[model samples]
Target: MIASLSKISSYKSMNPIITLSPAILGALVVLQAGLNRKVASQWGLSAALLLNAVVLLIVALLIFALVLVKADWFSNTIRPSIDFKTFSIWFLLPGIIGCILVFGGPWAIAKWGAAQTFILLMSGQLLASLIWDLKVEGIAVSYVRLLGIGFTWIGVILACKWK
Candidate 1:
């Protein structure tokens, strides 16, 4: 992967939209958290979460509609021959966790300020990603990775100043 990336001749030739997509998404997450926090203040956490999910559903439907306009929509949609029966109960975990995040993000921001909340969130993500790399990807945890994890936790501690 590294070799493939390095072979890209020039920065100008790279796809800026794809390269910056993650940063764009990251900014949206923070913006969404703040908006959700405001909504929770006006209504309540559950109501705000419901609104968030409803808006997401509506947006997704709109996107699907746009995509459906294409002549090959049916073929594209049916191209994926997923075996539902093969999926375990674990498949539902992402939705459940997403609900938890939608519910918890605003609550956490309201309690701990966005910076602290995000710091903790990043720390959790790092740990979870490391475990995923190890167990699922069969990647070995090097000392440098351990050091980075340690620094992350230390930064979280300093940022949060837990009571």
Candidate 2:
């Protein structure tokens, strides 16, 4: 294995968000399937339910850890370019979990699985987080996050109900 990959994997082990993403994602996927007319299965639903709780716990723990950061605003150090990592993991954790619930499995371990699921999940997570921040902490709106959420929703709807 590449040294960088190994190093990142090791670091991820320590990062709760990174380590628990897949399991939480898998769980959300199962629950969404259960609710949907197409993917409902009793056993899968149960497993998914468990995953949902885990993801929520992880997310809550993450918020709790933010006590150390001492700032709620975006960092000036980050730069003008959009950061994919921020969008994928931080802003969109919940909806991403939802997407994972809908499409996560062996086949989708790293493969292209469902576009709508991906888009909707991203939108729901990022925008919802922004809304939460706006309400809780009076966050100023950022053009990029707003744009991304709007664009992501387009992708979700197209993917889920395309003709």
Candidate No. with top TM-score = 1
Instruction: Give the Å shift of residue 160 in candidate 2.
Output: 2.6
At residue 140, candidate 1 shows an lDDT of 82
The estimated TM-scores of all candidates read 0.79, 0.35
| Model 2 misplacement above 4 A | 1-122
Each model's Cα RMSD: 3.6, 14.3
Least well predicted 10-residue stretch by lDDT in candidate 2:
105-114
- Per-residue lDDT tens digits for candidate 2, residues 98-140, read 5555445322322444444445556666777898889988977
TM-score of 1: 0.79
Give the winner by lDDT: 1
Tens digits of lDDT, candidate 1, 8-90: 65555779987788789877888888999999999999999999889989997777776666536666663444688899999
Candidate 2 structure, TM-score to reference = 0.35
Q: Name the regions of candidate 1 deviating beyond 4 angstroms.
A: 1-13, 68-82
